[model samples]
Target: MTAPVRTRSSEDLIRAEEPVLAHNYHPLPVVVSRAEGVWVEDVEGRRYLDLLAGYSALNFGHRHPALIAAAHEQLDRLTLTSRAFHNDRLAEFAERLAGLVGLDMVLPMNTGAEAVESGIKVARKWAYDVKGVPADRATIVVAAENFHGRTTTIVGFSTDETARAGFGPFAPGFRIVPYNDLAALEAAVDETTAAVLIEPIQGEAGVIIPDEGYLTGVRELTRRTGCLFVADEIQSGLGRTGRTLAVDHESVVPDVLLLGKALGGGIVPVSAVVANRDVLGVLGPGEHGSTFGGNPLAAAVGTAVVDLLETGEFQRRAAELGAVLRDGLTGLVGKGVVGFRSRGLWAGVDVDPALGTGREVSARLMGEGVLVKDTHGSTIRLAPPLTITEDELLNALATLGRVLERSV
Candidate 1:
């Protein structure tokens, strides 16, 4: 018989990781060992129901069989040929992804930030080349509290001090406007405006959903002013908010769609910028590229991811379970809750200050065998996988509710 494998417990692994890993993130003190569907077993063999979904990167759930099989098959066949040489899977993947998002073209990148940057480049080039903006004068208007990426240019326009402090002498030609305020967006864009980049729902800002019809107003404003309307759906898109794209909630379509995170189906890192011929075709050659931008391995995995989103089953599940989770927790609002937010399977809950902070609830919930995360100070955001059974969701919520009641 084979010897049983021995793995370090969660605490032991977390201790080792603290030294080597950069302090960029303060993750919940749980080391995941194995996961399937909606459950994660820590190194200690304690199974806590996953509620953050790797910040929505695992929206389809951990180690999805289809995506995993695709990755494995591609790993055995071919992985990378680089942009220097064309690969078989990239073209097909791009075509299908663009079709899924209803765009004409797709630019492959690895991270959400890269896709945002690519969109920025595409917008600026279009503004300069086609819209008659003066050279180096184009501006992209973004909202306050926007979390596009960590790159210098992205951090430059950020309103959050923590995200921007010690990060500047920032880039110029970017303007900030109050989120959910259409008039503010209108006032900020001008003749030099390259694009109006916005997230329909600000996921990182505690699942902040904008006022109704704000997205439609943005669409009209951008269209009337002849500016590119870019939607950063990296976090809120791909069925996290009960829609293929959250913009669908307002029936608004943007000129450019920035997609990432769950686009790889919880198996690999894949992102793409979906646009039409005029916008994406602006890149002739020697302009932008990534070493692994559209590697065959990612392409194979991406095709599976895109196809999975098309089924619409996961989105429906999210909507239903989300209703259950939010309804069950809403009663705590006046009693011990400081704030409550929900859409689909995503939620950002705030505990009463007297009961304790989000950290307290998360820690206590871990003891109860449920794992969620805190963000934006006291807000605890839950984004459970759509594949989780209702029984599992209810069980986790019972634990979650007990923790909330005690803290509230």
Candidate 2:
């Protein structure tokens, strides 16, 4: 007696799932059965190069051995402690992560949205307690086209009509200013302003890079106005952009840094809001926390992730490999690509209207054995794992070149 051989039926499975799953994600129909490093195999046993790396959450690559071992070991010892009591793994992870981010304190959470929310709370508290702002009058300036998260309050502040349309009565006190516009930012902030929340690179907005010196100028402005500068590096942080944090490219130290995504090492959800004693200390015991926020299992995985990033090995890999990927993409800039932008291992190429739509091109790439996703309308983002070998990246680039040529 033996288990029956499982015939490949991923396409059928995905089609069946179209009715059961939420419609929020308009995913391409390829059903992934397995992933290793920068490659993924469908249930049919056909492999496609993974160019998105789980939207940067797989920066350490799919199931890196160390992370898997760490997760396994933690599962054996403990899973969740509910945050009612301290867990052994939590403190060590916090201290190590604090040091890694060069921050005086760390507040752990489970998702990037939680980290952003924590930053908001900390800023508001600081505004009330330290800055002596009037109650409920504190305003946080956000950039246009920002995608913080999908939470109600987060969405309330979003500028994208698709993300915010008909969802209001939006949250009060959020001023939307233009991204990368220093003058607009300056004009928007006032004495009642609590924080300026921004992403160093707009990952969700098609890897849009800010103008040169934009981050530096924001840092200077935040410092001058006494407003807390919060960098939501959930997507651009953790070696995704070749730097430990995208702000590093401009040598700017934000008042509060929000980190998530790959910090979990592609295994568990780990997010943190890092700041000094003065900024983060605003929250006393009863004010904030999560049951699974800083639990032992997540802490364990996060610790391993910190260890991986602390070595700077992954950063170097992303930096070097990203250059190669970008170089290859440059060849498409004037061809079927209407625009192209990238930082580190991540790239966004907008297909020309003369070419097929991004969705059509993405489906075509999937057929050609390269898995990537389209963002916005005509933009496809390529974010291969940082662990991807030069040869694999080159091969993926060659595949993309073929797709671009055929798409037109």
Candidate with maximal lDDT: 2
Worst 10 residues of 1 by lDDT: 1-10
Q: Estimate each model's TM-score.
A: 0.96, 0.97
Candidate 2 versus truth, CA RMSD in Å, comes to: 2.1
**lDDT digits (tens) for residues 1-408 of candidate 2:** 123236659778877888999888888888776777777777777778888888888998888999999999999999998889978998899899888878888999999999998899999999999988999999999998899998878999887778888777877889999998999999999999999999999988889999989999999998999989999999999888888999999889898999998988889898999999999888888899898899899999999998898899989998898889888888777777777898999888888867777888899899889888887888899888899999988888788778778766
Query: Which lDDT values do the candidates have, in the order given?
Result: 0.87, 0.88
Per-residue lDDT of model 1, residues 135-254, tens digit only: 999999999989999999999998888999997899898999999999889999899999999988888788899988899999999999999999999999999888888998888879
Candidate 1 global CA lDDT score: 0.87
